[model samples]
Structures are given as C-alpha cells and as structure tokens.
Target: METFITYVSQNGFYIWEEFYRHFLMAAYGVLFASIISIPVGILIARYGKLSSWVLTFGSIIQTIPVLGFMAITMVAMGLGTTTVITTVFFYSLLPIIQNTYVGIKGVDSTVTSAAYASGMTRLQLLTKVELPLAVSVIMAGIRTALVVGIGIVAIGTFVGAGGLGAIIVRGTNATDGTAIILAGAIPTALMAIVADLVMGKIERKLNPVNKTATA
Candidate 1:
C-alpha cells in the first residue's frame, strides 16, 4: 500500500495523462459506435426479419479475440491510438446495437398504435413516442460498451498506443513492479466503476416511470 501511494505521488502527472488517454480512447470509440449502432438497431427492430442476421454478424465480430483483431487492424491502420480506437469502435458495436434494438422494440405497442391513430406519421411516432421511451435502454448499451472499452484499451500498450496499460507494462519490466501495476490497475478499475455509476443514473433518470415517481 505504501509503495503504491508513494509511486502514485511521485509520478502523478504521467499517470494522470495516461489515464486521460485511456478514457478518451474508450469514450471516442463508444461515441462513434453509438452514432452508427443506434440507427442500425432501430432499423433492425422495425424490420424484425433483419434483426437475426444483423445481430448474428455483430456477435461474430464481438467474438474475435481482441489482440488478433488489433493485429488485423494494425496492418491497415498501422499503429498508435488510431488503431486502438478503431479496435475499440468495432468491439463496441454489439452491446450498443443490441440494447438499442431491444429498447425500441420494448416501447409499449399500445402507445405506438395510439400515436399512429392520432395522425402521426411513422417518423413522428418513432421520434416522439418510441425514442423517448427507448433512450434508457440505449444508454445502458453505451454504458456497457464504455466499460468494456476501458478494459480493451489496456491492450493499447502493446500497439504503441499509450494508456494506463503503458504504466502497467512498465511495471512488468521492473524488478519490483507490484506497486506500479496497482497504480495502473487501480485507476482502470475505478474508471470503469465511475462510468457504470454515472451511466446508470442517466439511464434511470431517462426512464419515464422514475420521472413519474419523483414527480
């Protein structure tokens, strides 16, 4: 514990910078994935026949080994944060896509029918009724992707992309690396926990039932 504290105090700036990089890489990946996934999810949900195929493809992509995927990407994108970001982006697709599909589909059917009968077009029904109710589930998927991304980003060190993993790697090379490892590992774990908590709050707040209760 003393060694961990001492190492952190002495190298706070370096560690802080790496921590920021780690988070940004993960955040950017999830952000980009969300942009594409949410729409695709909605599309599949509307066209239920497509749901199985799209989700199957996502599952296959998700199953690929992280390091292997990184290596495959590195050949084209080359090294550094870009490669790491690309890998994170691909890996983030499934959770966000799945959650969005489920969330949109889960919206009450009666409400949707009522909206359509009230002279709303497909776009209006989707935008006003479906999306509002589904946002929380979509957020949950984003949260999962971000948390997973944080862990995956640790492999960034091997790809020449710096993150907290770089610190942990440095510890691996040292004669006494336990404290150094903890310095990096602790922050990574804490970051995941914080991300999950914040996203959970956002999800709950977006939920209509919660809003009614609080009101």
Candidate 2:
C-alpha cells in the first residue's frame, strides 16, 4: 500500500499521460475499424455469397500472434504509434464485421418484404429499417472490439508505443517491484471494466425495444 501510493504520487503526471496514450491508441484503431468494417459488413449482408469468405479472412487475421503482427507492422511502419494502431485495427475487425453482418442479416424477411412493398428503395430500407433495428448488435460488436483493443494497446508498449504496459515491463525488470506491476495492471483492468460498463449502457440505449419501452 505504501509503495503503491508512493509510485502514484511520484509518477502522477506520467501515469495520466500513459493512460491518455492508451486510450487514444484504442480510439484510433476502433475508429478506423468501425469505418471500414461497417461498410464491408453491409455489403456482405447484401451479397450473402461473400460473407463466409470475408469472415474467414478476419478469423485468420485474429489467429496471427499479436507480437508477430506488431513486429511485422513495425518493420514496415517503423515502430511507433502507427504500427500499433495498424495492428490494433486488424485485431478489431473480426468482431465488428461479424456482428454487423449478423445483425443486418437477421432482420425479419417479412418485415423486409413489407418495407419493399411500401416502395422504399434499397438504401431507404437499409437506413430506415435494417440499420436502426441492428444498432444494438452492432454496438455490442464495437464494445467487444473496444475491450480487445484496450488490452492490445498495453502490449503495444513493448514495441516503443507508450502505454501503461511500460510500467509493467519496468516493474518486472526491478528486483522487487510488485507494486509497480499492480500500478499498471490494476489501471488496465479498471479501464477495461469502465469501458465495458459504459458501452453496455450505450448498447442498451441503442436497442429499439428499449427505446420503445422507455418512450
């Protein structure tokens, strides 16, 4: 307890800075992933034949070792935030794409038929009906990706990327730095928990049924 407080007091500004770096890394990765994956998912839902192949590609990417991916990307992107963000972007793709595809595809066929009969264009049907109904599922995917990205951003510190993981690595190198390890590990866990809870609320708010009930 004394050691923990001492560390926090001594490294207060540094800890806050690393926390911000960790968050920004995850944010950029998830932002890019969401922008690309949501559109690709929409396309896959429309063209059912592409779903299996695209999802398989994402799964294969996920199976790649994280350090290996970072190392390779670092070689190309030259070991900094870019490499970590790029690696994180790839890691985040599968969940968001899969969830978006499933959510959009799962809409009731009869409801779609009715939408078509009402003279809604393909775009209109998607924007006005399918997407609204699917937002909850899509948000769930984003939540999953966010949590994954948070964890991976810590690993990014191994490759010259700044994050709380630096504290963990430093602690391990010290003779007796258990408090140091907890300093990083505890904050990382807490960050993940806070993110999950916040996203859970967003997911609930996005649910059409919940909206209707609340209305």
Candidate 3:
C-alpha cells in the first residue's frame, strides 16, 4: 500500500491523463456502438429471418482475440486511438445487438397487438411503443458494452494508444512494479464497477415493470 501510494503520488498527473484518456476511449466506443447496434437490433427484431445472420456476425466479431482484431483493423487504419476506438466499437457490438434483439423480442405480444389494433404503423409501433418498453433492456446492454470497452481499451497501450494499461504495462516490465500495476488496474476496475452500478440504476428506472409497480 505504501509503494502504491508513493507511485501514485509521484505520477499523479501522468496517471490522471491516462485514466482520462482511457475513459474517453471507452465512452466513445460504447456511444458509437449503441448508435448503430440499437437500430440493427430493431431491424432484426422486425425481420426475424435476419436475426440469425446479424447476431452470428456479431458473435464472430466478439470471438476474435483483441490483439488479432486490432492487428486487422491496423492494416486499414494503422496504430492510434482511432484504431483502438474502432476495435472497441466492434467489440461492443455483440452485447448491445443481442440485448436489443432480446429486449424488443421480449416485449409482451399482447401489448404489441393492442398497439397494432389501434391502427399504429410499423414505425409508430416501434418508435412509440416497442423501443420505449425495451429501453431498460437496451440500456443494460449499453452498460455491459461500456464495461467491456473499458477492459478492451486497456490493451490499447500496446497499439500506441494511451490508457491506464500503459501504466500497468510499465509496472509489468519492472523488477517489482506491483504497486504501479495496481495503480492502473484499480482505477480500471473501479470505472467498470461504477459504470455498471450507475447504468444499472438507470436501467431499473426505465423498466416499464418498475414504473408500473411504482405507480
């Protein structure tokens, strides 16, 4: 604990900069992924035939090793934050996509039928009803993706992308740098835990079931 405090005290500025960078990369990745994945998820839910193909592709992307995935992305974009962000975006897709699909699909059929019976168009049903009800589930997916993104971008240090991982890696190269490693790792873990809790709270708030009960 003493060594850890000493390193953090000495390198406070550097750690802060990297920690900030690390968070931004994760936030950006999750933001970009949510933008696209939510729509794709809705599309798949409407067209069940496409769900298998779309989800399968996402699964394939998720299965790729981060290093290998980054390597391939680097071929087109080269080493940098952009490459890391793109990699983060891709890595984040599966959970959000899968969750979106499941959320929309999981919506009560009777509720949807009532909406359609009231003369709602497909788009109206989706935007006004389905999406609203699925917001909680979709938020859960985004929460999961952001947490996952935090972990993925940690590998960003190797790709010349600065993040907390850089500090952790520095500790690894030292004769006894456990303190340094913990300095970086503790923040990363904390970020994930904090994100999950905050997002989970938001998720519960948005849940229709919760709203109904509260009412």
Best by lDDT: 1
Stretches of candidate 2 exceeding 4 Å from the true structure = none
User: Residue 211 of model 1: what lDDT?
Assistant: 79
TM-scores, all candidates, are: 0.98, 0.98, 0.96
lDDT of each: 0.94, 0.93, 0.94
Per-residue lDDT for 72-94 in model 2, tens only?
99988897899889988999999
lDDT of 3 by residue, 89-162 (tens): 99899899999999999999999999999999999999999999999999999999999999999999988998
Backbone clash numbers for all candidates listed? 0, 0, 0
Locate the minimum summed-lDDT window of 10 residues in model 2. Answer: 75-84
